[model samples]
Target: MAAPSSPPARPVRSRTSGPWAKLSTVALWMPFPALLWVGGYAGAEPRLFGLPFFYWYQFLWIFLSSGLTWCAYLHTTPTRPVRTGAHRPADPGEGLR
Candidate 1:
């Protein structure tokens, strides 16, 4: 009986400094409190859908950030190739099943 050949040895990958730093900074700082201040200030005195401007303005962002975070998470998520190529599958039966 023939034995299966050894698989390719994967090399360790250290995190790159530039893109990760830029991404982390942008990700962490993008949705900060000053943003709320800017948003509230911009939307002040603007009534919408029968809701007062000030009250609605702050709440608008609650929904907005939820969606934004979902999108950001999606953006950060790995695609088929990137994930599959990165490391071995978590479960042994992943490939066959």
Candidate 2:
């Protein structure tokens, strides 16, 4: 009987290691307060383009949250070295499965 070989070990990265990484994690939580606590800021005092403040505020967050997510992605993503043609996957369909 042949023994099973273990997969390659990946380097461990701390979630709060660097400032950028910590900011990236914090960016993800930006939307929770505004969206989750509806009654906290739900009011019809101010208006925008015939829309109520409550409505427009949430609608504006759609774009703002998207921008924040993009910023987090840019900050957290690591730059990898370009691979040469010499290095190839062990199996042609390795990732397909």
Candidate 3:
């Protein structure tokens, strides 16, 4: 039996580079610390729809955190290289000929 061929190695990409990357990293990480420091949102004033400030604030963070996470995703996602005609394979009929 023939040995299995190894897969081609992909280039190593740095996800933490660039300004957007920094913003993404912050977006992905800041919520935890911000939420953990409960003193910032511990008050009951400035109610929303009869909800206490503390309760509504935490709820608001849930959506804000999700939006930040999406921003981070957009910023950190790796873009694929566009393929040009040069990289395409010849037609099967041409190959057969």
TM-scores, in order shown?
Answer: 0.44, 0.63, 0.64
Write candidate 3's Cα lDDT for 40-59 as tens digits. Answer: 88998998999989999889
Determine which window of 10 residues in candidate 1 has minimal summed lDDT: 78-87
Q: List the pairs of residues colliding in candidate 1.
A: none
* Model 3 regions lying over 4 Å from their true place: 1-16, 83-97
Residues 5-95, candidate 2, lDDT per residue (tens digit)?
5454456444445899888878889899878999965988688998888999899999989999999887777654443344445799965
Give me candidate 1's TM-score against the actual structure.
0.44
Q: Each model's C-alpha lDDT?
A: 0.59, 0.77, 0.77
Model 2 residue 47 distance off true place after TM-score fit, in angstroms: 0.2
Off by over 4 Å in 2: 1-16, 82-97
Question: Candidate 1 lDDT, tens digit per residue, 1-97?
Answer: 3444555555544433556545754665656774657654664466788777777767876777777666655455544322233446579997797
C-alpha lDDT of candidate 3 relative to the true structure = 0.77
